[model samples]
Target chain A: MSNKLLECVPNFSEGRNKEVIERIVDPFRKTEGVKLLDYSADKDHNRLVVTVIGDPEGLKKSVLEAMAVAVKEIDMNNHKGEHPRMGAVDVVPFIPVRNVTMEEAVELAKEVARQAAEKFNLPVYLYEDAATSPDRQNLASIRKGQFEGFKEKIKKPEWKPDFGPAEVHPTAGVTAVGARMPLVAFNVNLGTDNIEIADAIARKVRYIGGGLRYCKAIGVDLKERGIVQISMNMTNYTKTSLYQAYELIKVEARRYGVNVVGSELIGILPAQALIDVAVYYLGVENFSEEQILENRLLWG
Target chain B: MSNKLLECVPNFSEGRNKEVIERIVDPFRKTEGVKLLDYSADKDHNRLVVTVIGDPEGLKKSVLEAMAVAVKEIDMNNHKGEHPRMGAVDVVPFIPVRNVTMEEAVELAKEVARQAAEKFNLPVYLYEDAATSPDRQNLASIRKGQFEGFKEKIKKPEWKPDFGPAEVHPTAGVTAVGARMPLVAFNVNLGTDNIEIADAIARKVRYIGGGLRYCKAIGVDLKERGIVQISMNMTNYTKTSLYQAYELIKVEARRYGVNVVGSELIGILPAQALIDVAVYYLGVENFSEEQILENRLLWG
Candidate 1:
């Protein structure tokens, strides 16, 4: 087997302060095995999302070091953003990229959660695939009242923390560590500026509305461009391919006489996801990732 | 910039002898920074094709070691094969994979060719992009007379070896070394077993027949499977993408009323080649390889 690669997208609560964000991301940059793919700070959301991929052990160590920096430099009590959060180091989701199983990711998540809780005296909750109970599986459920209400909410038996003290950390608050599949942020732009058409199509093409099994979508107005967009989070590309969502959107848009102008991939995504879409569009048979020379060099 | 990567596909004369094939392939397997992507031996063709990619220096060293092994074990005088050949080590093509230009590949090829000829007392002829003259640009032209005729062919001033003695190596014969674009071996199978229909489509989809500029194709009968195939070598995917070839074949097949049953990729191909096909078929706007997570992780 080749190297086990795990993608970790860690969100932090202090995006407005450049120094704090840089400090928190330092370990990831310096870590030997860890590759820092991308990092961005949203001023409106006041959140920093850092994308990284590396071996489980190296990733665990690097995340721990970054978490320590976050605990030291960020104060969640003073944090304010458009996005919801419950801690200085808000959430860390481990995604299995290559040569790694979901079970292994869950195990790694729990291990990192335990280490962080013990090392920093900070409260940690296991969510998503690493959740101890079904009720905690959804991240929003655990972060219901955000940082302010977490202190009181954590004391409840049903809402007890997975690790460390039940009470929230005085300044850092609490963090959620979990394992999940890679999420693809895909968006389709329609020729018409009518937001209603995009909204109608998005409703019929998402999982919540009985469409694709693992797709979550919302319609947004691209005011500057005079067009509407069907933004989507493809939670599981294996079950709900990019092409399926694209074709569905095209079909639905045609109902309202709207043509798809183009599409956008918001961030980094697994190469296999796009390869699958290529196979579908090209009607290729017996296609394998091994046939791609670069993948073979990296994985072989 | 990331490390420069070059792909080398070397064809050896002895494929029937497992021991000799293994000996020739061992250096590539053990060399550092040189990844042995694939190695296959065809009994009928009596040839061994080894695909590898790595840093220039490391790859050159490994190739030389393998060539030495091939020179010692394989004798062209006693060689018998269905595939055309003129040496123990028939041909070595250097392809620029990533961060490496064609000029650099040509230089590397010339360097390796000179080294091999000097060290082995073997005659080496540069072909393809590294050809000393336009007449030697095609491997088939340089290998016209085969091993037995090379002794006299080399005597001609126009056919003098690029390096070493003008005469062939009595036992090993002459080797061809050069640089060229990555060659993609793509085959599209048709539903019907009508070789004429396949041949007609192949003629209309190949460069020689005024079809795609970078394509070379021929019709082949898959007798056992009861189908005819258009076997192709896409010499430059950047200029003539896989989709362009596939689409052209589809258009030509329509003339003969034959349906495409399936397609096959014979060996490893650059990921960019497939990505181009996906972008064209999906009609995606502003798609960049940086958006692919694995590419970013590996090359960013």
Candidate 2:
């Protein structure tokens, strides 16, 4: 468990130009001790998302090198995007993946934030686990005023940047960096077209509605499929297993005389999350991670 | 999917002597491209079990090296164990863990069997998937005659080995080499202590009893816990999942008003077996091995 792994997902403003995107991603590829897991761009959002995992120092080094490219290549004033943006290198999140701790991740985020603000003269706000106050914990709140609105918003007394000068950069604008747990995007489709059932179950299973502590749920209507989905963000799957939420939804659906058609897991998730569900369903006792053959290949 | 990985488990005769056990295990450690996953010696059984995984050629080379050490250190003429044995190295099974096919594993098994028999001057029988006939398919049937009994048994026309001489070695007896699918040691325990319910369900659920295609089940009485268990070996988990067998047992138990009191997974199993169970219970569609973070670290 002392292997020390962290995932860094940094989003940049430019997405259409392949050369610029490659230029910004080249450092991550060239950096030692860092593996570029994936990278994708959306022309409409005009955003490029790069995912990489490595040791703390290595990840920090790569992100800084990549940030330099974004700063030199992108100017927020000339940027146009369908998605909200506040800076050339919009946001970066450091996730504690394996042996790394949240506190350590928070420290790593702060170090990157301070170094980035100093190097690029870009205002940085710490959000989520790395936030200085509760108000800064939500990334959306800090990024509420997009690139244009952030120019005037940065001057407010309570809206001061956590790192660098109070003023936004002349071109790059501002950015947000944070440390947070891995999120599991899970959706359970009910065998009915009643969106209200999905809505009610979503509210019942979400954290605010007194369900799982680390869950955030919403209802989605899959019009073409003729079914409703209870979408969820399992913020901490270790504490709140995906199966627990699925079973709870199934129980709730039974009351409404509906069956669960199927479920979907969006994006990526830690292998342990899936293993936990396997152990639960199979009722496996005395099972260890070492029992999993891939664990040896991954760690040893 | 093209990445070839196979598991080789070789059982040796000498377990009481620490020096001999270490000597037999040394080659697997020193060999490149091979990982010595586990090795345990049971003094009562006077047997040494070694588990290793690697590319086909690497695994074959390591096993042959270890077999030489085992053959040199232990004399079958003086060997005795609670478990049945007919050679210094009793049996070797080649299991396709990932990407590797059963046909490829069988070829590897045959190559090892021919080489081991020629070098060591020991008789080797093909068993399981590599069996030349249905009678030689079971390791037990081939090894039914113990070392003392095997001397005379080997000269019989029907008992001739697929490799090496028809007669046994002066010190090292005959051996069995096999290629088989990954087997799952799964047990589903019931709330009742009555052995009949467990036995009846076991009969209804096993392949021989018109149930799952690849299941072998038996009922065990747990006097201490006041429960019964349906112990099973899912010989081919791909065709017959652990969940399917467990669910069927639950349905059968319900007829007798018995409840399932959890279950136990014995020894090591391939990770795909666990993932298959997760996919079944969670109803997760479109989930790929690539989505598991460890898979990126493992194959990437």
Candidate 3:
């Protein structure tokens, strides 16, 4: 069997203060098993995004250490950010990397939530695939009122925290822990400057409007570039690959005689996604990732 | 910087004797740094192929251990095979995997060749990318004949062994050592049963016939299946991506109204190859392997 691998992307609400951000991320750097691939801080958004990969046990340990620092150093009452926030530590989503089932990832989420609640006396809400109730499955549903509104909402029956006391923490606020698929930010630009046509195509291709499944699409006018775009977030590529989404948008945009200018993948993507597109576009038969020499060189 | 990685494929002359083959391969299995990825024995060809990947040092140690075993157990005079043979331990080709330059690989080949000649008293010839002489750069030129023909060929000034005595070893015989790029066996089957069309298309696509550079193409008739194929081996994928080759063949085959049934990659390929194809086919702008979540996870 292949080796076990998992990805963890954690968001923190103290990006403006460099010392605080580094202090909070210090534990991850010191951790043995987990590797800290990258971390970025945005002053405007007042948020820090950290990317990590490691064995499940090691990742859990590192997250706990980092959270302890966050709880000790960050106070929600003094925090202000453009982005939505409910805790100093904010949101943490665990993604299965290799040889790990989504079910196992959910279990890991629960384990992390339970430990955080017991260790720091903080409230934790399970969202997405780890949700105990159907309503909490969507993170927005759990974070409905943001921090201020959630303070009052927590006292209600449905708004109770999944792993802590119904009462919100004194200053650390609340955290949402979940297991979910990686989200790929993909965008396709049209050669024409027809904003209405781009909007129509985006609406036609998005999931809510009966387009591709697992795709959330929206049209935005690239005013500076004199073009239109179909911005999309592929929440689950396994169900609807990049090629499917691109082709759909291409065909849909062509209805108005608009030609595709180009496409951009906002962030990192899985190797399998690229392979899937290659097979479809190149008409390659019986191609496998194992057929990739570099991949084989990675392991016996 | 990342650790330097290399792939080595060693060919042995004794495939019929399972016990002898196992004994010869034991060193590779036990070596610390070297990873023995695969080994295959062909009775008809009477050859054993062992695939390994590792650091330069790891490969050197493993090769020596395996050579010692081969020297003790096999004799070239008694050897019989459908494939060419000059030694019990026939040929070893080192391929740079990652972060290792071709020059470094050539130096490694020379060191291994010198060690083999000095330690085992086996004559050695360098070929392919590591050849010292322009004429010896090709394997066929160095291996002019099977073991029997090579005995006489070795005495000639032009055909003298690069290392060890002018005479071949009494039992173990001579071994060829060199550094070369990985060869990808790529075959494309035509949807129609037109042998003449396949042959003409193959002629138009191969390097010798002015098709794609770094590509060797031949047309074969799959008589039983009643389909013709354009069989090719891509020596350098960086210069020619899989999709580029497939696209050209598709275009040429179209001249005769031949539809491409499918393409086959005979062995392992580098991840970059597939990534390139995906980028071309999907029109993915500025795509990178690091964007793959799985690849990022592996790095971390």
Q: Pick the candidate with the highest TM-score.
A: 2
Predicted candidate 3 versus true structure: per-residue lDDT over A168-286, tens digit per residue: 78788899999998788888989989888888988888888999889988888999999989999898887889899889988887688888888888777677777777777766777
**DockQ comparisons of all candidates to the true complex:** 0.69, 0.73, 0.61
Worst lDDT run of 10 residues, candidate 3 chain B, spans: B291-300
Q: Number of the top candidate by DockQ?
A: 2
TM-score of 3: 0.95
- Give the C-alpha miss distance for residue A277 in model 3, angstroms: 1.5
Count of clashing residue pairs in every prediction: 0, 0, 7
Worst 10 residues of 2 chain B by lDDT: B291-300
lDDT of 2 by residue, A78-172 (tens): 99989989999899999998788999999999999999999998899999999999999988899997989987999998999999999989889
Query: Residue-wise lDDT of candidate 2 within B84-123, one digit each (tens)?
Result: 9999989999999877899999999999999999899889
In candidate 2, stretches whose alpha carbon ends up further than 4 angstroms from where it belongs are: none
Any runs in candidate 3 off by more than 4 Å, and if so which? A297-299, B293-300
Candidate 3 colliding pairs: A268-B291, A269-B291, A269-B292, A291-B269, A292-B269, A293-B269, A293-B270
Candidate number that wins on TM-score, 1 or 2? 2
Return the TM-score for candidate 1, rounded to 2 decimals. 0.95
- Superposed Cα deviation of residue B171, candidate 2 (Å): 2.0
Model 1 Cα lDDT, one tens digit per residue, A90-205: 99999998889999999999999999999999999999899999999999998899999987898899987899888889999999999999999888899988988889999999
Please, what is the TM-score per model?
A: 0.95, 0.96, 0.95
Query: Which digits, one per residue and each the tens of the lDDT, describe model 3 over residues B235-279?
Result: 888887777778899999888887998877777766777778777
Candidate 2 backbone collisions, by pair = none
